[model samples]
Target: MIKVLFFAKYRELLGLGQMTVELHSTTTVADLKNRLVKEGGDHWAQALLADNTLCAVNQTIAHDGDAIADGDEVAFYPPVTGG
Candidate 1:
């Protein structure tokens, strides 16, 4: 299973900080985001916009094509803001 973490508004929408998914070797970051969008419906769709959202795999930010494997940890969040 690949562990997934959601932060900020995403966490609130999903009511979860983390989850685990079983995916095939062919799975990519883009695929995972699609799955989240499907599961979370309209609300998650907005937060998961590819251009605005960010993803990390194993604590390192990853691109859309990055391959995901079992036991990997993935996190998603929006861009941060600071004073």
Candidate 2:
């Protein structure tokens, strides 16, 4: 299972901080996002599909093509800005 975590605004919007999903070993970050969108419906689409949304795999920033496997931790959060 892949552990998915939502942070900041996303956590609030989704109403959950984390979840576990079963995915193939070859799944990529984009694939995982797509699955989440499908499962969570419009709410997830709005939060995850936004252009500014960012992703991390196992605590390191990652891109769409990054490979994911069992026991991996994936996190999604929006960019932060402060003065």
Candidate 3:
């Protein structure tokens, strides 16, 4: 299983901080996002697809095409800003 985490506004929008997902060995970050969209529907779209959301794999920034493996931890959040 892959551990998925949502941070910042994404957590609030999705109403979830974390979840475990079972995915195929060939799954990529894009695939995971698609699956989330399918499962969570509009709420997922709003939180993930609506903006330039950032992602990290095992605490390192990752792109949509990045590979994902079992036991990996993936996190999503909006871009950070400061004054």
Candidate that scores best on lDDT = 2
Q: Is candidate 1 or candidate 3 better by TM-score?
A: 3
For each candidate in turn, the TM-score is 0.85, 0.93, 0.92
Q: Name the lDDT of candidate 1.
A: 0.85
Task: Please tell me which predicted candidate would have the highest TM-score against the true structure.
Answer: 2
Cα deviation at 70, candidate 3, in Å, is 0.5
Error of 3 at 50 (Å): 2.9
Measured over all alpha carbons after superposition, the RMSD of each candidate to the real structure, in angstroms, is: 1.7, 1.3, 1.3
> Which portions of model 1 miss their true places by more than 4 Å?
none
Question: Model 2: per-residue lDDT, tens digit, 1-83?
Answer: 88899999999999999999987667999999998899779999988999999999999999999999899999999997758
Instruction: Pick out the ten consecutive residues of candidate 2 with the lowest summed lDDT.
Output: 22-31
Flag the better candidate by TM-score, 2 or 3.
Answer: 2
Candidate 3 differs from the real structure by a C-alpha RMSD in angstroms, to one decimal, of: 1.3
| Cand. 3 TM to true fold | 0.92
* Pairs in clash, predicted candidate 2: none
Q: What's model 2's lDDT at 78?
A: 97
